[model samples]
Target chain A: QQQVKQSPQSLIVQKGGISIINCAYENTAFDYFPWYQQFPGKGPALLIAIRPDVSEKKEGRFTISFNKSAKQFSLHIMDSQPGDSATYFCAARPTDSWGKLQFGAGTQVVVTP
Target chain B: DAMVIQNPRYQVTQFGKPVTLSCSQTLNHNVMYWYQQKSSQAPKLLFHYYDKDFNNEADTPDNFQSRRPNTSFCFLDIRSPGLGDAAMYLCATSSPLGTSGYTFGSGTRLTVV
Candidate 1:
């Protein structure tokens, strides 16, 4: 079973607009949530992450709002830019595990100029 | 700066032949992981090494195996690859210290003819 499910397999947004991607999980044991951004022909890099203890975490233009009760989380990018166009992934794992991760099907975000 | 590296970004092999993908890290992370991702699919964890201990996912194929010769190097070996195995293989490393994020290497694209 897919532990994490993400929506909008592909999305297109105009520059300077807000971009949002959502993910839901089935495992309640997962406490750490992380989002990753990947470019073509490149590896994925950590964009932002949030622990279940916190409701929201923001860094620069990227924000991760987590709803622990809902077992859902989302990534919001404010004032989107073309540089932000890429694949975004939401992943989760149990706090006690090592290396075993469950990832959401990625969302391909395109910010058009 | 420390980084994770994957060798031979792309490989093509015969259906019944064996293939190996290598990953190395300079971050001195105690944990290393391997993931398989098909087109537009989420990354699925195959296995991982925590220090000297190895952990494998339940559904991972018997054709897949892994070896970690030392702290910085890990290898993924496929014995007689199938066409369905053609996908992007990602390698990642992390320190068991805490809830911090893992560093990922540019994936190795494996194709079986």
Candidate 2:
């Protein structure tokens, strides 16, 4: 079963617009949430991450809004650029799992110029 | 500057042939992971090694095996390549301390003909 769920399999946005992707999990033991960006023929890179203790975490143009109670989280890319186009994945890791990550279905974001 | 490196970024093998993919990390992280990613899908964990202890996911097929000779090197061996096994194989490393998130190598794209 998919431990984490993500919406909008694919999304297209205009340059300078905002791109938002959402993910949710049912496992309460999950304590770590992370987002990864993958370009064509490349590895997935860690974009941003947030722990349950914080409701939101922002890194430059990337922001992660986490809702513990809702068991949901979302990634917002500010000022989407053409180069930002890639597949984004949301993942959750339970405490004491030895860094085993459960990933959600990825979202393909395309920023058009 | 490449922390994690996967050799033979692309591989083509005949059906039923055995193939091995390699991963090496310069970071010397204690935890190493292997993930299988199909097109437009989330990465599925195949197995991992913490130092020298191998942990296999329950659902991972027996046809897939892994070996970690030391802290810096890990290999994924596919006993028999099938058309269904054609996908991207990703290698990632993380510290057992769990201070930093995973660092992934550019995945190996496997094609079984």
Candidate 3:
């Protein structure tokens, strides 16, 4: 019953390396896709988001690559740093759902020196 | 400076005891949502309030309830705490007219004994 599915439950990467996390959804009604980053004992913060009209959106080192036809999207973190180490969640919201978000299983990313 | 605030960062309650978590927002958003996140898992939506109208997820337990007495405040009440119910409760807010994304509070970690 999970609407959104994410891969690579956990990953480790060296500093300055690239870290990628992928997510997919089966529902076409989802129009808004957002990625959240969470640190231990804190709330998930919005890192970046994208609408279906655009194929990709980038904010600094964080990028979200989306494919509408394929029903898939991925997050890429360039120049991964220790500060970026945390749990990442991909979420989708349906157009008519009144802002309700369905989240993926989440991925734990670790950056090593 | 607008943000969502959750009180009682940590709570421990005996089994079968009732507990309530509070959330407040200064952003004056039109929507407020409560989510439950277990260890190393994605958050699950429990319910939401849209300008005083309550919407509950079908899978949410009967023991859980929510109230939004006013625009700035929302409360989550657990009628009876159980060991299985221990988790982090997160509160988030967003404006229906904007696409900026939600702002989340730090969350309340509940431990059942």
Per-model DockQ? 0.68, 0.83, 0.78
Per-residue C-alpha lDDT of model 3 across residues A7-54, encoded as one tens digit per residue: 889999999999999999985488899999999999999999999999
Which docking class does model 1 fall in? medium
What's the candidate order when arranged by decreasing TM-score?
A: 3, 2, 1
**Candidate 3 Cα lDDT to native:** 0.94
Better of 1 and 2 by lDDT: 2
* Residues B1-113, model 2: lDDT tens digits: 75999988999999999999999999989999999999988888999898999999999999999999888899999999899999999999998776667999999999999
Count of clashes in candidate 3? 0
lDDT of 3 by residue, B16-53 (tens): 99999999999999999999999999998999988998
What is the fnat value (0 to 1) for candidate 1? 0.71
Error (Å) of candidate 2 at residue B6 is 0.3
Q: Which residue runs does candidate 2 get wrong by more than 4 Å?
A: none
* TM-score of every candidate relative to the true structure: 0.95, 0.97, 0.97
The candidate with the higher DockQ, 1 or 3, is 3
Model 1 residue A6 CA deviation (Å) reads 1.5
lDDT of each: 0.90, 0.93, 0.94
TM-score of 1: 0.95
